[model samples]
Target: MTALRALLLTVAVTASLSACNRRDREPAADAPLPAAEAPAEITPADAAAPMNFATTSPYAAVKLTLPNALKAQTDLHARLYADEVRLLRQFVEGAQADRSEAGDDPSIPPYEKTITLTAAAETGKLVSLRRDMSEYSGGAHPNTTARGVLWDKALKQVIGSGQLFRRGADMSLLDQALCAAVNTARARRVPGAPPLTLAGGGEWTCPRAAATPFVLAPGTVDGKAGGLTFLIDPYKVGPYAEGSYAVTVPLTTFRTLLAGAYADEFAGQPAN
Candidate 1:
């Protein structure tokens, strides 16, 4: 019954690379451009990729579960699947190497990495995957990290913050929004719960940087594409006892600053 902590993990931006591209255009002075439009049809399938079975290693140390749609016959999907395999393999090999080196150290117990799919859904044209990964090496505690994977099925490439956002956007405002969300969540905690303290029990606090940690939550026609959910690890924004916090902001709050398919798909959709 380990607590799931949302870590600021990194996922490679190789899937659906081409789909995030935008065509160049110049508008005339005093001329109004056409308003953005949502897709003609907005079916559940249109919003997300198909489901898939889970995969694991014979050693029972490494496991991988992904969308069935991600394992399609297309080259892009193949590459995506391969990438997943490679990442799991790395964890397996690293663990094995650690065990080999720990032969004389009775205090170090061998452990394996378990990657479980916790959430999978679609937002606009993007398919998002959230995984809870845990591995115990020779340390005081096991390493558990919450990770995110964002893919563009149309472009057959994975994406990251850069692909999801436009240039020259007001990043500081976005950071402030995240801080406010986290503080608000903290306020809702049960009475007497451990409070989230500053980094040093002083004025030091979470920074309003461009690379604020976050994960994309599921989005439906009813809910639409709200602002991306910001994820802060237990010790990152507060004490370890405070655990982790995830807070959501409305897309309308920063819609004008977004770009690419993420922006286009939610252009005309109402936020919740």
Candidate 2:
């Protein structure tokens, strides 16, 4: 998804009002980074297991696409994907109603909307699910945002940051590390871009202990534990133009902060 896709989820209803001053939708100058590196396909062993879902939707006009590994598994994840599809359809229907109520104008073009949810990473008992939405409904530009879910199969639950990290650990250090990685990534992606600081200034503000948002990144090598991947939404750290930022804090950096079975998985030998 592009930067514009970052705003789509929130703008579903207000697109009609914003469309009045809309400019021609331009392609994003930079592409949003992928949440993680995905395996080309589900392995033969995983594929041997049966998985099934209604791929096409008559109500939402949406399709449920899942990674082969995720599809092959018959578990809570399958139901999660189904629920995602249902929510997406609701968003689309809401957006369409807004458009209809706003009335038509020759100057305003038809809306083109897309919502996609994908599994960014699946290793052992953990899976990362990412949702990307992009919609253009008579606005100066489209809106987009990518959201993620960390699913723990053994626990049979969605893992939150608080549960993942040990209590009394230094969250400030985690915040600092995330900002540094974001600064480095920004400089590389935009040559000569001004650097960001911990303070609220420049491209974005750093997230604090209470508001650190993150997703899991795929390891540099397949099936390895890459560690926690931070998600910096537009306006959360920077202007909407910066889109969303994803910074991975390697497992090695804060192994001590991890807790429970997931922590054991993070500390274990890298998967080959």
Give TM per candidate: 0.64, 0.69
Instruction: Indicate which candidate wins on TM-score.
Output: 2
Model 1 ranges off by over 4 Å: 1-60, 68-77, 104-108, 190-204, 207-209, 219-223, 267-272
What is the C-alpha RMSD, rounded to one decimal, of candidate 2?
Answer: 8.8
- Tens digits of per-residue lDDT, candidate 2, 56-166, equal 222223333455556544454344444444445554565456556665444555555454556666777787766555555555567555566666777555565666778
Tens digits of per-residue lDDT, candidate 1, 191-234, equal: 44344333435533654534544456544453345457665555
Error of 2 at 101 (Å): 1.8
Runs with alpha carbons beyond 4 Å of true place in candidate 2: 1-64, 201-203, 209-212, 220-223, 234-241, 267-272
Worst 10 residues of 2 by lDDT: 1-10
Which ten contiguous residues of candidate 1 have the minimum total lDDT?
25-34
